[model samples]
Target chain A: MVETDMNSQAKADRKAGETVLVADDIKRHYEIPQGAFGKPRILKAVDGASFTLQRGQTLAVVGESGCGKSTLARVVTMIEPASGGSLRIGKTDVVNASRSQLAALRSKVQIVFQNPYGSLNPRQKIGAALEEPLLVNTNLSKKQREAKARAMMAEVGLRPEHYDRYPHMFSGGQRQRIAIARALMLDPSILVLDEPTSALDVSIQAQVLNLLRDIQKRYNLAYLFISHDLSVVRYIADEVMVMYLGHPVEQGSRDAIFASPQHPYTKALLSATPVADPEGKRERIVLTGELPSPIAPPPGCTFHPRCPMAADICKRLVPPVQRVCGTTSWCHRPWEAETESAA
Target chain B: MSLLEFTNLSVEFETLNGGFRAVDNVSLTVDPGEVVAIVGESGSGKSVSMLAVMGLLPWTAKVTADRLTFQGRDMLSMRPKEKRKIIGKDISMIFQEPTTSLNPCFTVGYQIIETLKKHTDLSRAERKNRAIELLRLVGIPAPERRVTAFPHQLSGGMNQRVMIAMAIACDPKLLIADEPTTALDVTIQAQILELLIKIKEENDMGLVLITHDMGVVAETADRVIVQYAGQQVEQQDVKGLFRDPHHPYTAALLAALPERATGDQLPSIPGVVPGQFDRPAGCLFSPRCSFVFDRCHKEQPTQAGKELGCALCHTPLVAGKPQNEAA
Candidate 1:
């Protein structure tokens, strides 16, 4: 059976530590036709974003709605091709991977969407849903595939008896667990989790988080966790990337980013996040105005318009990326603020 | 004097599955110039209770209350016309999704003008000017330009501000914001909350905030009402609620927060909130509660005292009676 070989291979894979993914200045821009006679406008959904993912680690990309984090995730998951720059997963060049290589890439990299119910087919049984990935990616026979599906179900903490049940029979958290199980069916090295727990309740969210953490530890999988919830990021992310209007404002280890965020935007984000403690009084920095539209983003520092400490130079020239205290922060006045106290 | 008061208010919806009680004998009061936050998760009846108060629930819903009063006027006994007069004039509401709440066909300025026209007798030019003034008051940049823009043209935060502007167009005495900032970004949420606080203080209006986020409740609410399975679990001043929660559900909810988790495993409530059909005969939260015992599964327990904070548990988890008596 493939189970014995697969189990040993997984163990070996865990032992071999390696860089799983490297994304360099990846850009995903879309052109939309304005009207019948109007010129097409370019919407830079993701403009010049880069990050690295290592096995057994999670790199979280945190941003608001228009900040291009989701776009970046889509690009990584190969749902859409990047407009420019390079994306390499292990040895495969993501942009130009051949047909066979693309299939291999699909097996190596999988994605879990925000809504589990939407991701899974309504009519498909839980067993068939988990088996579909194996059938597409591998040449496993009927009996072998069924066994693998059952094993995967138990691995995700679902009963093997639940294999024949439909998705609607399960609760939201259970459905998400099935989604995670399906993603792990191919034994993918990288999992692009896009707001996996956002739709779930808080208690359920904690359960899913614990599950993901356990899965990462067991499989030595690299996770590209994309979420807008900072508290979740603080709990799960090894490294964090803060995005503003389709650009990276700050990226570093979770400790450095949370403890001592250099960019004013990062500081404001941290300050704006309401703490659960009612007695704790933290300086709440409320940024005025809304997130600038990605269609015609502000020149120079994209955050300059809403930035409180914006100077003349900030508007005129783009801020250079400077490494300070083990973090890469892009800002004009990085030294204006000090590190914040830990929660 | 209380601006809004609900005594033994219960709301039930008639479905094929029978009457599903959403708000069960929940009593609370909101005074003028006070911000009362109703905190609960989905299906906890926080929003439903507020909707019942607004008289906005569907026709299928059966609402019954002992004393549903607003500014000493009996809301339950009042004629439909009289109730309609006060609603959207003296009492206005801003929903969670600002985009959906505001009419997409009309411009924001037009909506504000419509609200002003319905409630107040302002002249054409005066209404237009007041609409622009309301936009400026909510801190929209270039109110002159934004007033003409449609809801879709504006960002989520801007639309929310526009909603706030429209909600206060009649200079409403009470504003019911149901998860007003839930749809916005954190920074944008902070701005909206600050704006709500500012407006509530300046206008001297009672604000009823319904939200699921304890952080927002902690930051903005003057008093907190914790709901569980359509019943009031605990009610206290915002500070006292956080300092020492009386109910296990409230304590567990606070503990479940990612920040409060001192260990790797968060103290999560094991089961989900039971549906109306499957609700246990005793305490509704007994299924998920950690300290559930025999009595918790047998008979429902009532609140301890009228003035002091109390929990709906057989053995009330009293965190020393809250000194501040709610007026």
Candidate 2:
């Protein structure tokens, strides 16, 4: 795998293409069966979220648990159809695509789940698991698919001899590598990774992150990385979108979000995340109260209950989305904190 | 005097194959009103050592210690009843999964009151009032309503708060919290840690926080203990530990954090923590240590300081040198 080297050529080729995935006001909600009392409640899993992922770059979706980030990924990956809005891959409209079109779109966008062990069939060998995608997606013969699987295994830093091994035989990190290899087997233009390395140890986590970086560079694949870890997001994401209770509260570049977060929820999240450096100390903003249930969300600004600077206006009126300091933040008081800090 | 002290403490479990030593010669002390953190990866014996102290090990395990004392009282030699008096009263414990640790069938108030009843002489109504007060102390809103709620009725963070209320019911002198906030969200974790620190300070309690996250240790711990492969490799003040880690393992661990990453790639330790059967004959970390030499393979090194802070290496990193020089 190390024998073949492509420097800037693949990156330049990737940039030559247009946006890989464009999601415009996508929504995914579920109807829950309440006690035979009143109308059924609607669980707004992914409510009116929109973002565009460029080629050769990563767009990270971050939030606490139950924030609808994973649901957005599911919608993009076509695991579940979006209830509203449009999703496009290149020029293909995935939201309202037909059966054969979706079959083709499957090779364009793929997903890697959080638990690698659960994603892969324990009974299947690594070679067979990797080849299954090729068999279903392409018209390649069995021998050709086997050769490609061995090459893909080697490309992911695994030996060809280990291709015959079962899923249980590999470690957590190795299994994740296999999962990544399987996702890339069809050469998908877009990859949605959901908490890929959260299960591995720190040392092993580093290895997997580096491996992902190398694979990204080689393939120049557009990644929709979903994680709750800000530190990892800071390292991997070119752009970030902060979601809260099925709403995208803030979206900006990595530097903009990390250096100067405008939204109160974004600020709270950044401060609450403890820095690994012991010598590095910063004042933390601890949010009070639990996340409101998505089934029955609060009116107006959803974060007003736990927001530190929440005013009377915040509770009564929905904050309008405004561009502030290179970031689009939905807040009642936008960039006021930044101006004060500057003064 | 220290509130709790353990010297040369070791714990081993007898499996079907053979004996597996979970903890090895770990010496640590906790002074009153201080937060001492034990940091390590999985199977590093951080949890096992604390479990040994709490006498919560399974029947297959064997515990040994030259000195184990709490408030000048010998814990290892104490009678069964005496140990019981101190275990839940003066020295309480909290675990990672509060949902599992708490009894789901019983109300939160009942559990807190039971702890109070076992340790203090109070009327039933007084115990109930104290339970409500404890819930308020742990920052649970609407304590009166929450006190009667079952474990399933509350969220993960609220259940953890209830667990804390029960632990501090007896006003324990020492609280051993094992990964108390590991299962909660970051915001919730910050709240829980702040509550723990506030309670520890107000009551002058010594807290032993067992966690693997360096960020949590740096933020909450006054002193830090670094363990690897069931042995205590390094111990230092929080500032000192971050500024100049003595052991190669500690330095590597800090470097491995994604937040501390500098270049395009991270400096990962090459291998995972060795299992019991695959451990090296000499230094436990020699296989993964980048600074390992021929001597490190043949013999184990000991801590040079008067206290038990050993790197177990011949050519350990000096105070001023860069931590990732070997990398």
Best by DockQ: 2
**Model 1 CA lDDT for position B1:** 81
Task: Give a tens-digit lDDT track for model 2, residues B31-51.
Answer: 999999999888899989998
Off by over 4 Å in 2: A1-17, A139-141, A337-343, B306-309, B319-327
lDDT of 2 by residue, A219-239 (tens): 878899999988889989999
Clash count for each candidate, listed in order shown: 0, 1
Q: For model 2 chain A, give the 10-residue run with minimal summed lDDT.
A: A1-10
Worst 10 residues of 1 chain B by lDDT: B318-327
Which regions of candidate 1 fall more than 4 Å away from where they truly are?
A: A33-41, A159-162, A336-343, B306-308, B318-327
Give interface RMSD for all predictions: 1.1, 1.1
